[model samples]
Target chain A: MQKEKPYKVKLSIMPFWSPLTPPMGIACLKSYLEQNGYSVRTKDYNAISSLFDFGGRYIALMKSYTPVDRMGNIAMVGYDVLMAHLIAYNNRDDFSLNDYHELVRQLILNNFFYEATDEAIENLCELVEQFYALLAEYLINDIKEKDFDVYGISCYSLTLGPSIFAFKFVKKYFPEVKTVMGGGIFADQFNSNSLELETFARKATYIDYFLLGEGEIILLNLLESNFKNVPRIIVSDKTVKKVCLDDIPLPDFSDFDMNSYPQLVAYSSRSCPFQCGFCSETVQWGKYRNKREEKVVFELRSLTKKYGKNIIVLTDSLLNPNIDKLADALLEVPPEERFYWDTYLRVCDMAEDMEKVKKWRKAGLYRVRLGIESGSQHVLDLMDKRITIEKIKSNLQNLADAGLKISTFWVVGFPGETKEDFHETLDLLREIKDNLYEVDPHPFYFYPSGQVDSESWEKIYGYESIYEDKYNEMLMCTYYKLNCQPCREEIYRRLELFRERCEECNIPNPYSLIDIYHADKRWKKLHKAAVPMLNDLIHSGSAIVDEYRDSIVLR
Target chain B: MEMERKGIIEVLAAIFPNQTIDIGDDDSFIDKLGMDSISFVSYVIGIESKFDIEVPDEYSLPSKLDTLNKTYDLLGRERG
Candidate 1:
């Protein structure tokens, strides 16, 4: 552990999916530590914590005196087109909140933050302490002008609470720079719980080393050799290595500004060729490898022509692991410079390809997502998902008739699942709620690497541990003292009274263009006092995402 | 091009992944592998889905299919 010369190593990657992309496991560990030499640098302070928590939640939702006569100037130009595509991509061309969501309504942009108060999570915890005093003034100016040693961050369990609020101000103002942590939520909650590595060794005791799983040859053997021969170099060891997927590299993202982002992410399969036992996505990337879909269409055409962008976003947990070699490599691209991706497949990989999902939808494979966690094949065979509830209703009608765009990732309590398998998953969401374009429901989230703390899920249902659920105060959620056939709080109170009986049977929520105006009881009590300043512009985006980080990270 | 010759051998086994791409018939298709302008529109979307045939935007064309008999007589005159 010694570094003096020009060994400069920085890496950063903090704030939530950094305004949408560029921290792909710290740009493949800064291209495998600059092809095994060293000198690496990356910051993406969640792209400046998504331009100051989306430009301070659109200046706290244009001073919300919410009368919405023209829905508050279309919810303040959909928060300035989602904060000018989360700040001028500086990586490419922009303008988004999905292009003024063709004039606002995914429930007026989900009622522009409909449920976020406790004074909008204390004004998103004061814009997450001014986004951790702007990552403690960029790690105290890279520890006084990059006289670097080592400092990786990458954590992803809702950016591990903004990498423990920037590893407690980089040990209170660059305490002799040397921290490190690795991604996929400290490689699936470090060695699956000893109370999550004794609460991450007492909140990452200024993390000297924790590079657990596939962190490129334990971050090129803890930054180019030293520290007693590396391999799973966790200082206080947990041991996990993984690299040779045909010698990993090709991911530089040249220290990022990849035209900022909102697309362009690669991975044509890593760990997910179906390990679905209420997946903790193969805890620390182990099996299911795929890459060569012609090297994922030549790294999506040389990283979308060096990030000019052509909409990719693959981050493969299971992107068609050989849908006829992903429709013979998206039918050899070039259908108008093909590459429009958007992955995640398994509803049994679009139920055995409807003619190679119509040549992977003319090789751009538009949006797919679908974990369809359960429509009850006895709770998808207690989540082992050997699939069959008629291949999750004929693979969501063959990926919406192979035109794609379907979105879903359902899960509603799974212990021994029953109220007749939650009324056959609300009769398979009221029989494919019109070929569902988006649903995203969740309830059962008790992970220590989900297989619900196995002993074969406690020798056929018994779990025993119930009551932990803290969720904030550095996470704590254990739950499961069941021992029976249906009890995750009576299946999370019949899935919150089955989402108020799918908004009293209007059943919409494919991300809200209409839940028939919140299935009104007088426009849901006059749009809940007409958006009380859209809950301080939706929990000031909880100073850049951490709340149940959408229920336990993995995927 | 008997079976439009295995869809140009699955677009040269998807642009040479784990190689051994044996294309011949006077190999040129824009000087063989450097056909930029996006791999010549992915080699005309592998010759319009390998002769599922649509190649006509008023046919008559051949600055170079350079040869498998000019990429099978430009797909038999864009399949007539």
Candidate 2:
């Protein structure tokens, strides 16, 4: 008998977020590897019951070493601080009812903020120490263990701090395991020249390989070549250039436990055509290119067959450009199977094809999220949205007529948006309120590129800085100069006005609009206040806040 | 079976009066009801709210909710 494949690759994808299943890239790679006769096993570390298994072990050890009563007091104080940070973070984002509860539970055991400070940073180190200790113990106690040839850790720009700790821990304990890094965060950095390359390069000591762009193609190539010097990153090598989307395989959700998620996510296309000033799609994915329509249909049908009829969320930048093709494909599927779906579509498409809009209703397209960036024509033009007030009104009305729920994503502070322009947006919203199911208005985030050049940047923020990696750029804050006062104040006024309007109309703010400014002001008062609170909560030994559990939102 | 078909038609009529609700016993939901994902979900939610019946996780619209016969069976199962 032929000997079983020599290499048994135990692939693991761990994301800090709940649904940390391997993305399409990993799924495609899995399929490719399996087809080529490599024994592959993928574990979603995100789904493992205890999010803070490492942290919890540390706490237990600490408690055992110290007096039980003193440890209890320390744990209680830590828990209180942790709860405060959880409350503050959740309040910043409008979390759903269920998400808030889950976040609280996860926070109790998992130290999400452990990496926020140097003191708490030690806790993370201890946690990792315990994690490896437990892993070794498990291998000895449970069954015969074989070493994994390569261990890959996925990282997003936002979660870089925690990721670094996790990477270091894995490398320290399992020195034999080849550590590789890949994902959107790295891909974004490699594609755009704007990212902080020096910082990444300095931090590269821990990572063995940074598989840039679509990792499936490069990773498989690297693995098949027996870890030979391939085009992709091979520690101490220059970054590999970006790859095309066509090269990647369709993502497999089969390995994931889908029941944990509330919504089913599907992608019809990659990238957006329009150059919206605030969006990073263009910078990241390059120009828009859709997967073959048949591929999307097959994926949808397969998912429905496997998961039963579930809500399908189209994770496309714009669903309207290929609306006809999508509508045709959806029509082929039974309506019951297509029960509910949501997608972002351009307003222009809706205006052109009202009948198709109606057909979408027939095809079970429940929600259409339109990016009505601003009501002012000037602001809309400035953002390069290429839509008019008339088109928005007509498209919205048509959708309503077809019995489809409409959700509008509006931005309050475009660089040139005057107070009067904001009022116009409110007026526009009021006009379309009857036709809409919800309205989400965010303060304009001055992303690194688009219409905002050096002059525009200086005019808005009184400073000009080029974004090294468009993905990692700090875009959470708004910067603009009004006749007097700060632009953030103007943004707040617009948000307040928008909230007041929603209240007057008796429409519930799904995002808890008040929390935006509340959290913003709290953070602005003392920049480090929230960070320390978060760190304490993550390092805390017990559960803390529960009253405002329903208020926290995670995106 | 006729009674169940009538119940399904009644729900569809409430949502879409302009469109005709002529569907064969063997007809598909998308081809027959002229409903898409959005309307199908709205209709499902509406039925659940109106009839006070819980739709099962496995029940999909148009395809599964297509035939009045299948819907009636699912509804009975859910209600029971």
Candidate 3:
């Protein structure tokens, strides 16, 4: 009574990046493919030793400099790797595949944190020599085993380097299979950055197709009809608008190794409703949309049943527009079965309601990350953040009273922000330091898709250069050489003082995970247990250190 | 409380389980093993937890943990 499934595809989440959360886009595509009666397989190669083992080694080395946290240590090491390549590149305007990979290969072998002696470098390279062969063999066998017609990869800012490595592996070994690349990184990158496309895209010539916008529909169209031409790169003349959020199926996470990630990401909404000039999130997501409350509740219920009491982070934009209905559905989850969760929430008069805040906390809302943006009303208006300081202070009190942790994000170094305006952030920090769980002040970055800021840079102001001169488009690290009021140095000093104030007020100045256990008498014991468990999961190579005896120092 | 060879190896293996360590009790850690100053502190933490000893501030220096045999003697001599 069942139709035979013939189509096979391999969706891969590459390594040397964040292991705190699984790639939700890949999981969504897998679910869609299976529902369409296609055989789908995934390679969460991020779980392997090549990435995690390297993190463990680097962490062990860097502990003397400063202690790294249990979460996001992998990404920390990845940036260090990227830095080594940048140093080797030495601002070269031209590059070749052989030279670039040679630098990467040199990094994998030696100078993880620092330059190694000849003997140590030799030992390190010999230890990882098996890794190169393993990657090639793995890709070849997987393509043959799955009888894969297509391979998809998920790329983000930090993953740009390693994703290319995986791309190369597929190109060299399984060249016949069609390679498709799609993720948040490529959404708006295809537009008018033709110089970026020309230089960056040509290096990766093996890729047959690129799906733009929401990946689910684009991927379905490509695989279902064996179609390659789409509104991507220069030649394609089609760009698909995103389907409504309710149309997307619950992500099939069975293909992922959940043990490798620090927390599970449960999606509820997409894009941000507010068009703040500072963010490029809308460029990737197109428009704001929410899944039906019942459908969202169903996804949560299934996830909870599978992984009991795991920390679930809602990977949504600035705020969920349907906050009330989302809370109502969360109430249906049994208290014991309920998972601890957090999401970005907007601050407004309605959010300041004490009764609603209490209800949301009872439904397992442990933390709420607020995009306060700036403490000064003038700067908030300039950035088009449609909220008031009074509303935020009021809601901060309400959320704290409901026994919920607060993570307020303040963006410093905004265009036209004066020193007097930055002091307002210090004033706001002093007001809520005790009640807050964390206060993160992010530096302003110039992203390619940030229209208002880019216009202000050249037209309104005289900031000439945008990104790094060489390989600007391909490398996604967003930084700018801006000539602005309250220069980066002054912003840096004020942030240091703000950090000191947080420390004085006994607040943890961390943006990663937070806990209410800090107030409990048994907090120390609970923290000790949680740290190792979290550390093991986020850096998975600890499990197989014995297998690769030369990689670590055994007594 | 004399330290045992098996216990030290077990603790070291737990921390860095992948490497083939050539142990010499008298060989300096910097000389025999390729570990740096930063990695030694982690080994000290393992030492403290495994042997039920508090590694004093002075014991944290690489000079104190220089040799395998000297380190074992120091551990057995200064148990907590």
Candidate 4:
């Protein structure tokens, strides 16, 4: 008998985060492989209960081993609870510091029972180690029957540590499995000539290939030839130029369970119009290119039909300029059968098109997260934001009037941001408080390849401050006077004042506004006092949310 | 007592008006009535000032609505 044609080589793709279940890139590759007569399977490691079990146990172990004796009980518990409270509060200004303190107290007294127990710590560590081993076993055993050729892992900034460890463990057990890593974080951080990148590539021997940019075509090519001298592939001591976006196949999310993820992920278009000072998109994709209108509508129709009026989140650089096309496509959707959708858009675009706003609402758009950047005209111009305060206010009001929840992102402390500028931002928040469902304030982050840099940043701000490790490549500047040495107390004072003003105004406090600075100064103090208790509370709340999904908005 | 009940009722009504909301002395928030997590959180915050109870960590707020009513009962017990 003729030997059966080797079963189509099976390919598995896994995401490190749960809400990351919609593996669009992986899906695109899967469809391509299937079309080419290869078997494809995708898994979201984030949804695996075993990961959470490991995480909880690991958290428990860390809490138990927390050197309470050296730190003193008051400081230790206090710091842990404080850190946890900050994480739990997570950009909500509705609650007071008193509220956070009280919640931390209760959490320490109740939920943090494991932290005080040595037996619990031991058990948790054992469970974590065992769970990870078993997880490796399950993954390896699952693929053992299929005779898989390669495994692809999607890595993001938050999921980097977990995905790296998982990839290494999987490789150790199944040495034959060629592991490939790719994603936004992997591409941004490792796809360069940095000492850090070199170290990572050298250390992680298991990760055979790091497919930069879009992985679908490159991955397919690699698998077809069985990874023998592939083009656009990065291995030890080799670099490749960025791949063209058009060359990659459209993402297929059908195989993965998208419902398990929060945020309905979709991309109407890629590439950005404006090259903002701080954006990585400009560096990654090199300017804006709108996807073909017909292709976009076709994908939307397919997703809507399959997902049953799922919330369609456009992971686009800007969706406003294409309002006419989007509106026409949405008109095809029934009013009652409408799906909730959200996207980022330029304030200037929205201000110009009130009719577009109205159409979007009718099309069942629930939320629009606008990058207002700053309240000060000077700051806006300096950042090359090119949008005015009046435009922001008008567009925000228009969106809110159209019955859509508006979340505005404000970045404070850009280089050259004066005391007046910060106040202007606060004033703007106060002015627009009634119209906004939420307002998030993020501090200026310095990343690689931004308009702000050490030389330019110092010239603008007249300060010599070392950038954080995470933001070494970008230039970040904040307006807080306390940021200057010997006056950091003033920074705390201003932050507290900002928080108080937000509370008084009933506006939601942005995530990391106060905590980011505070952590910078006394991370150890805060981490020990409040982090543990707060984490317990957030996890507990998340658990309740998960258990009672039908009762809550759930997302 | 009447004023407090009215205040609580008004807040709950503002959040969920059309739905029939039953407040019982012995009923649990999550188990007996099934208030869910987000609603239960809002409920907790809305009543924080009224009850003179401080919940420092919103995360550690009881997962079970049953546990929440017990806290309410405890507050009542202290008052009584």
Task: After superposing candidate 3 on the true structure, give the runs of residues whose Cα lies further than 4 Å from its correct spot.
Answer: A1-7, A53-147, A187-195, A228-241, A450-453, A466-479, A486-506, A509-555, B1-80
- Point out the worst 10-residue segment of candidate 2 chain A by lDDT: A528-537
- Give one digit per residue, the lDDT tens place, for model 4 in A1-555: 233222344434432233322556556667666656667677666444334334433443445544432222221223333323322332223455444334433334322332334454335335534654666666776666745666677665445544565666667777877788876654343544334455566656778877655555566567667667664345322233433444444566665554344334667666677766656665544446576666666666666666653456777878876756776676676544445566787887654566766666655465677888778998898788888888888887777655565666766566567788878977887887767655555445443322223335444445423323222211111111223322332333344455555566765532211122222223223222111111122223222211111221211
lDDT of each: 0.54, 0.53, 0.58, 0.52
- What does candidate 3 score on TM? 0.71
Candidate 1 residue A19 C-alpha distance from true site, Å: 22
What DockQ number belongs to candidate 3? Answer: 0.08
Candidate 2 residues lying further than 4 Å off, grouped into runs, are A1-25, A36-40, A43-147, A186-191, A225-249, A334-339, A447-500, A503-555, B1-80
Superior by DockQ: candidate 3 or candidate 4: 3
Model 4 ranges off by over 4 Å:
A1-21, A48-147, A191-193, A231-250, A335-337, A450-501, A509-555, B1-80
Q: What is candidate 3's lDDT per residue for A39-59, written digit by digit as tens?
A: 777777655533334433433
Q: In candidate 1, what are the lDDT values of residues A1-555, reduced to their tens digit?
A: 234334667777654443445667777877777776677777776554223243435333433423333232222233333322222121121334233222222222232323333443334334444555666666676556645667778776545555655665666666766777777764443444436555556645677777655677766666555544553335212344456665676777776665434456778667775666666666666676676667767777888766656666787787655655766666666644544667777766545666656556555565678787777787777676776878778877766655455667777777777787788877778777656655656666444443434447656554554322221121322223446645544654565555654555454443211111122222223222121121121222213221221122221
Q: Which ten residues in a row have the lowest lDDT in candidate 1 chain A?
A: A528-537
The number of the candidate with the highest lDDT is: 3
Chain A only: TM-score per candidate: 0.30, 0.64, 0.76, 0.67
Q: In what order do the candidates fall by TM-score, top score first?
A: 3, 4, 2, 1
Highest DockQ among the candidates is held by which one? 3
